[model samples]
Target: MNNIATTLFLGKGYRVKKQVRKGNELRVYIEYEGKQRCPRCGSENLVKNGKDTKWRKKLHMSFGFFRVYLLFKRQRYKCKDCGKAFSQVIPILRKKERFTSFFKQAVIFWLIFFPFDLLSLLLGVSRRTLLKIAEEFISRVMIEELKDKERLVIGMDAHRFHRKDFALLLVELLSSLPFGLIQDKKKAFMDFLLSLPPRVREKIDEVVMDMTVRYRRAVEEILPHAKVVCDPFHLISYMNHQLMEEKRVIEVVKKRKIPGRVLRLGKEK
Candidate 1:
């Protein structure tokens, strides 16, 4: 048995008197300790009241479900100022809640580590709920690392989006995090590049990109200090297949009974 799990349960309003595990099932016998003050006048003076009836509920664990045997030790407090006897509720656990604190922790961990559908299947929660938790975790921990940096080298590239062969991406090289997607029009890409700080813009040493003339023009227009270099692989591959492309287009136009010279010039153009 994990003592930390037992300690977490005790810290979360459950007094675990005994804990035993049989096979994969863990059984915990706990007593719910009521509040310390009098319920009527909120006085600290209290006397022992008789034990309430025992209650049984199921709690989820990592391995399987365990039956929690709860002995409600209700205390009747005699108010010194008002002279009234009343009961108080425990502060840690909410009223009528069946799942323990450890169980909640397990669910949160699962949501962070696994995908939404898998986490929903494991914890018996809806996928939407898991996605909400995942988004919360991302909001709490994941923030823009490129912002407020002394030097930021941003590289832009196009990635395949569905059937579209190219959707541009901006990468912050210092943090190795994706900054923004640059697609659609030239104006959008130019605007994104111009938004960086002047000092950070001056610190940019080099811009590595494929042999796209528009991308080169945009980088030169925005980042004046940066030297542009054509990424060799894209240039070489495009060059090697350029002739093959012209031949294939010419053959297609000839098969359609169009003039081959005009079609070849169009393919070359």
Candidate 2:
């Protein structure tokens, strides 16, 4: 029945041509009715050019005594307007990739229960492909995590890494996890902030930092909505700075260099 085919191959776009089973291995031959748009120019003017001579086999996971495989005859299309060749855009398949999107989901789901080697052997895919898939999955998950935050409290500060080398550290204060390390906090940090997804930027509730003029200016320009709260140590340090300056002025009024020690609190210190 088409219901079984639709469930196995992902949707109405596919029609079951044939189904073969030998022992525990199951092969489902199908045809795809996919989006006929040019991937290059987004034009719908396409013409059937040719079809692949061989069937492309994708390893879909196991289902109760049966290892499932999707066999598809890929069709090629030539864009009439762009004069370029393209393939049908399947929502469940990545362009020029062999496996379906469900296959990726299945692999990620089962990897928790299976060893990497066994999973790779069962899927008949190489170890390198598994690593690549895992990396892609982790990257997508991290991005989703970043985007899903309701409120993000950010902290940014410049620190001297070594003599004559300075760097900017940007982190989520709530999570204490650093997301960005920039060579310069000035323009680089602003650029990094700008590069963040607009949704993420909108969720920034506050930014904590020392009263670095450039840092403050960057925040004002990029994330003006976020509250800027100066760190406590910097606030005390600032008071000490002003006190030291007033002491220097008092010494100048006395018309002599002060011999007593002053509180060594300055930006350099």
Candidate 3:
């Protein structure tokens, strides 16, 4: 039981001290192993300050639909060298977070494929918390992926999420990863493009988008070096419409000539 509890709830550098099963929830009490050390001063010479007055409860990833909670009394220690007091760092939990790192990671993964509300309900976490996690994760990833690039090829598109609200999406064409989503009109779109670094904007080689005049104009103004390529779907659709109109004109001309031809033939006869 101890081994399973340790493997389930405690990560490296941590050991399970005790576990209690209450109703549907499993509460595993945990503590750090080895000598206590100060985080700031890294001194092993320490004295017990006191046991934390409040129980710190952290939510862990569910096991087979049963909720798991990690309960620990964060031990406070006073360092002799630095004369500073700090609580022992929990290896499995992030600083000042109510959920374990494993639980936060699971939430980030689910937010990619699941609806926010659905994930919140399934994980028993608030929707606002889930959104905040997703936003921070996405922002970090975007900065890391885009910060060092010298050149880029981009694709721009928009989809209507509401009657009057549209979301403009910009994707890196080579990587096929989205870089930006602007929820506004053409003015906002241009503003976003202009907000990019001048060197980065100058590095844009090509932009692929639907044949919207506003988008074309914005790209031309903001990224002077980028060659704008209209999406083939829109180009093909336009050509098909033109071809149908020409076919209709030919049919009308043929109908008009038939009566004249018949009259001439009767007069000759």
Q: Top model by TM-score, which number?
A: 3
Off by over 4 Å in 3: 34-37, 63-65, 152-174, 178-269
> Once superposed on the true structure, which residue ranges of model 2 sit more than 4 Å away at CA?
63-65, 95-98, 112-131, 147-269
- Writing each residue's lDDT as its tens digit, candidate 2 over 1-269 gives 58867678577767788888878888888787766888888898899999989988876665545578888877889998989897666566676666778888887887778865677677777655765575466544544566767899988777653456566767788877566656564776777788778998999989999988888888988998999999998999898788778778877787766543543433321
Write one digit per residue (lDDT tens) for candidate 3, span 122-181: 887766576556545554466357657877888887755345555676788887877676
Q: Candidate 1 vs candidate 2: which has greater TM-score? A: 2
Q: Which model scores highest in lDDT?
A: 2
The TM-scores, one per candidate, come to 0.38, 0.49, 0.57
Name the runs in model 1 displaced over 4 angstroms. Answer: 1-144, 147-152, 243-269
Clashing pairs in 3: none
Clashing pairs in 2: none
Model 3 earns a TM-score of 0.57
Pick out the ten consecutive residues of candidate 2 with the lowest summed lDDT. Answer: 260-269
Task: Looking at model 3, report the run of 10 residues with the lowest lDDT sum.
Answer: 260-269
